[model samples]
Target chain A: MAKILVVDDSNFQRNQILRAIKDDGYEIFTAENGKIGFDLFEEHSPDCILTDLNMPELDGLGLLKLIREKNTDVPVIVLSSDTQELTAEKCKNLGATDFMNKPFKKDQLKAVLEKVFQ
Target chain B: MILTPDQEDAIKEFINIGAGHAAGALSELTESHVKLSIPAIKVVKLADLEKEDDSFTKEISSSVRINFKGFTDGTAALVFPPASALKLVSLVSDEEFGTPDMDSVQAGILTEIGNIILNHILGAIGNIFQQHLEYNVANYVEGEIIKLIEPDDSTPDLVIMIIDTQFNLKDLEITGDVVIFFKLGSLTKFVEAVENVLS
Candidate 1:
């Protein structure tokens, strides 16, 4: 089973993502912000990470850079409401595996996870 | 409202950046081309919102409202006339609905859209200005603007920055207003940020 870490500031958005993937059998760790998320990444060494871009303390880009320092192979998918092509490009340049815009469908998220795990 | 002409222009430039990014997010979500027209912004008392725009105050509308406070304190809302809200939800869900009334499911979808768009706009402002903001959960409400956005009791004379944003998606044009009602004291801080950016 793949261990996945999910990080976001909004409880509602986190719950929505959890509800979408709860039945998928992935062992999940959750954090409310990127700092806690990076700490969880260090402890659990999850196979993949899904994170929101804007957060207090530490942001998604910051977390991605932190994760890359420790492990470059683990897939880090960035979820953001920022639709700027430059944002996606910046994530790519920073080693993010994928970028999905927020308000994404459940199936869309699930499919992306499936592709990542496969 | 005490801003100089240069300061006001700077504020509008910030708002346009935020709205442009939000429009891009909407376009991606709906898989359509979305263009944002230059936003028309005005400052008015909360009581005078009806006098400012008929589409927002007079028509039946659906809105998602979020309250946030940090470097600046205020309420922000994405207001859509009923038909436009219904059309947008339909476009997202690939469903056909004859009525302008949105069901729970449709409202949920609209709330999500609003959350994304509003977040993008606010997030841009926060990032560009380096302000830390904490947001209340997004709320979906329907009906008149007065009912949707209640005036703050503590600040009886709340000033509102009404940003009229028009989203042009493919052939259909949808109009929504991003209304940010700044608390009395906080407006100064926001203006200061604008001036700081200028200097």
Candidate 2:
């Protein structure tokens, strides 16, 4: 089973995303902030990571930027409430696999992850 | 969305855009330069759930609510005391409607004001994130502040932003509470966009 890391300061969001992808048989691990997210990433070595852009301590971008230094192969999908071209472009430049807008449907999350995994 | 310094500043600026837009609309409406600014933005829990006798929730205030959509979708309201609401009605209309309670006509005026304020804010927010948003017709509801905004499926660990804005009618203060109820799930994305601008 593929393991996925979910990082978000919002518990509600974390649960929503996790629930959307949980039934896929992927082991989902969650962190409240970037620092913990990175620590878990190092330990769990998730196949893919889904992170929220804004968080306390360290944010999703901050984590992605740091992770790129050590491991550029790990696929990271960035989720944000607002969709700004500049931000999405920057995330892509930082080696992000994809960028998604929030209030994502279950099918949307599943389809993206399926594509990434394939 | 935990009130980090960066997130806090971003939220304040976000609200500032909405406030500025609302003020602009009011200026155009009244032909007077209305001064509207948000002094503080704080994440607050629902008063009814937090305290039994919350002074903030004690007042018999009237509210005009609009459905805020795009990014973080939910309800946004401009809540004020009944007298203040009446005064606002008086400023906008040519009729003498100085009643303690908001009559149907006064309520209609309040609804229009609420729609104006919300549309301005929603437009500013939607434009900021490069998204288009549409809000439903503004609804006027009178009662406790918490009850007015609280959703049917109560959020447990719920926290909302209290945008304190001072609406001025030429040196006179129009005391109103700009309360927004968000589907917190979507705020994660909203904050994400703010961080994008910051980064």
Candidate 3:
């Protein structure tokens, strides 16, 4: 089973993401902020990481920077409502495997995960 | 109106970029072509919101409101009148319109839409300022315009910036307003940040 870590500050968003991927058979772990998310990442070494861009304590960019410094192979998909080309470019420069905008469709998310694991 | 022409121009450009992204998000989510009209920016005292425009005072609307702090503090919302709100939810969701069960579904769908739209705009501001912002969870509310923008503890004398932009979607042209209010002292901080970016 693939382990995936999902990090976001909003409970509603976290629940929505959980509901979307729960039936896919991946072992899912969640955290409310990037700090907890990194802690989980270190402990479980999730196969994939999905995170929101704006968050308290540690934002997605900070988490991505932290993750990239230590591990290079794990796929980190950065999600945000900010769909600016510059935002995506920054994530790519920081070594994000992919960037997905928030309020994403369930099928779209699942397909991205499938692509990542494949 | 308090802003100099250069500052106003800069702010408009910033907001336009944000609205363009928001339009794209709305278009993809609704499977409709969304077009954004130019934004009209105004600074108004909290107590004078009703005097500023009929749209802000008389219209009964459904809105998803998000509050944020950091870099600046304020509220942002996606507001639609009742008919437009119903039309939008009907276009996007599987639920039949006017049904009893739709009340909850409408709130859910709109809240998510608001979350996406507001975040993109605020995210643009954050990026332009190179600062981090913390946002509260998005909330769905229904009321007249003043009720939509006023926080519980807002001082009546404080001034705010109101940016009103209209989004026209598909052939139906379901109109919605993207309203952002920068709280009292935050408007100055916001404009200063914009000027800093421009400089």
Candidate 4:
């Protein structure tokens, strides 16, 4: 079982997130969008998920809600370019673990994952 | 809407800055020197834009679009030419060209690239303007290009269309768009920021 599930519509971002977390020795599974992400989530039940807010089909928020409905405890961190406080608040209210602005630092990703998985 | 002289200059300057940032980010990611030229900015009636040679349609056969509301109400999109998109996937994946599936992988790469480029541009705008903006969910579609442009109910406003021409060190051309919807009032502020930064 992978410890992390990196979900986004972008290969570059998925790769960047995967590269950042690979050193933690956690198996990583990736999905292109929310629909596939949810399917993978059900199958692998990863400890944490890093997702992009803007994605085709089911978006990050929709995926977050779906994942919460199935297993509310899994950490779902939103990664998006939209930095409005309202978006962050909405994600938090919907049971997201945290929100990280896009183009995040390497240490920030590790720190957030540690906080959630610890 | 015809922009004042100051607004035109500001708009150009704003795009120039945004393009510069995008170039830096692409260079870092690709590890190849990348150069981006200032996109020719234009403000034409929607009807006029639709009738112009249909180059955008030919360039992007399929796309996924997302409309961002708040601060600015405009549509942003991710458009991919089939062959060029496939080339990008091959470049990023280091996979041998052996009939790899195109649909899912192509969608994945384009969506990610669009996400990065759009985010970088929007983030730069937010930084310069000192306002926070939020993005809506991305909607995927594969069909005629005309379907991408629907009438916005948010009162007709200025549409800022930026055509990104990316060139790697070897002159590999990766083309994309950064379209922003601007409300009239905020459009003034945006223009001011452009002028301030440029002048």
On TM-score, the leading prediction is 3
Q: Model 4: DockQ against the native?
A: 0.31
- Cα lDDT of model 2 by residue, A26-46, tens digit: 999999889999999999899
Residue B20 error, candidate 2, Å: 1.4
lDDT by residue (tens digit), candidate 4, B58-170: 44455656665545556666565555556665665556456633667656655555556565666566666666666665555555555665554334344545454444533
Best by lDDT: 1
Q: Candidate 1: deviation at residue A80, Å?
A: 4.5
Error of 1 at A110 (Å): 8.5
Return whichever of 1 and 4 wins on TM-score. 1
Query: What is the C-alpha lDDT profile of model 2 across B1-199, one tens digit per residue?
Result: 4768988888788778877767776665455778987877766555334553323457778888766566676777888877777877777654577458787767876766676676666656776777655455457898877666656625764556667777898567887878777676656767787777778
Task: Compute the lDDT of residue B193 as modeled in candidate 1.
Answer: 86
Which ranges of candidate 2 are over 4 A from the true structure? A1-118, B47-56
Q: Write down the worst ten-residue block by lDDT for model 2 chain B.
A: B47-56
Instruction: Write down the lDDT of every candidate, Cα atoms only.
Output: 0.81, 0.74, 0.79, 0.66
Provide DockQ values for all models, in the order shown. 0.17, 0.01, 0.27, 0.31
- Per-residue lDDT value at B148 in model 2: 65
**How accurate locally is residue B42 in candidate 3, as Cα lDDT from 0 to 100?**
69
Name model 3 segments beyond 4 Å from true. Answer: A1-78, A82-99, A103-111, B99-102, B149-153
Better of 1 and 2 by DockQ: 1
lDDT for residue B149 in candidate 3, whole number 0-100: 63
User: Could you tell me how far off, in angstroms, the CA of residue B120 lies in candidate 3 after the best superposition?
Assistant: 1.4
Interface RMSD of each: 6.1, 13.2, 4.4, 3.6
- What is the descending lDDT order? 1, 3, 2, 4
Which of 2 and 4 is ahead in TM-score?
A: 4
